[model samples]
Target: MFGFGIPELLIIGAIVMLIFGVGKLPELGSSFGKAISNFRKAADGKDMIELNSKKDG
Candidate 1:
């Protein structure tokens, strides 16, 4: 709730909707969700990193 009332939350939601628009809002939300997911996965050591080493002739 963050101490916000119905009216205050409505105002904030309206502003966010206006700024992002209904069409792109879902995409933004999905992207945010993915970023959070990836961060969590990395923290849990689930992310993979590849490194290549070259042999000297």
Candidate 2:
């Protein structure tokens, strides 16, 4: 894991918690997951955009 052991990861995680605080962590994680998901879809030649339309009668 890039030469990062448990102690180094703990320190890094602590720093992130201090910087972003506790509340914003889940929001950040959600955005990160979405970004990776989109990246994978694009890499796999899948359409990442959706369009919806309705016709009025």
Candidate 3:
């Protein structure tokens, strides 16, 4: 993907692991997932602020 081959991907993944560490991987992944979800919702014209207010109320 993105013009990256297997070796390039493995190297990038290793660098990420070194920077974030193994323990923080899950938390980072969860945050990334949430961000993608929010972006998709926003792209679909759903307002996040209104949704949050509704949830809180």
Query: What local distance difference test score does each model get?
Result: 0.93, 0.94, 0.90
Please identify model 2 stretches exceeding 4 Å from their true place: 48-57
Q: Is candidate 2 or candidate 3 better by lDDT?
A: 2
State the displacement of the C-alpha of residue 36, model 1, in Å, after optimal TM-score superposition. Answer: 0.7
lDDT of 3 by residue, 1-57 (tens): 689999999999999999999999999999999999988999988855653444554
After best superposition, candidate 2 residue 29: deviation in angstroms?
0.5
What TM-score should be assigned to candidate 1?
0.69
Clash pairs (backbone) in predicted model 2 = none
In model 1, the worst 10-residue window by lDDT is 43-52
Candidate 1, 11-56: lDDT as tens digits: 9889999998989988999999999999999999889788899999
- Name the candidate, 1 or 2, with the larger lDDT value: 2
TM-score of each: 0.69, 0.78, 0.78
Q: What are the per-model numbers of colliding residue pairs? A: 0, 0, 0
**Candidate 3 Cα errors over 4 Å, as ranges:** 48-57
Model 2: what TM-score?
Answer: 0.78
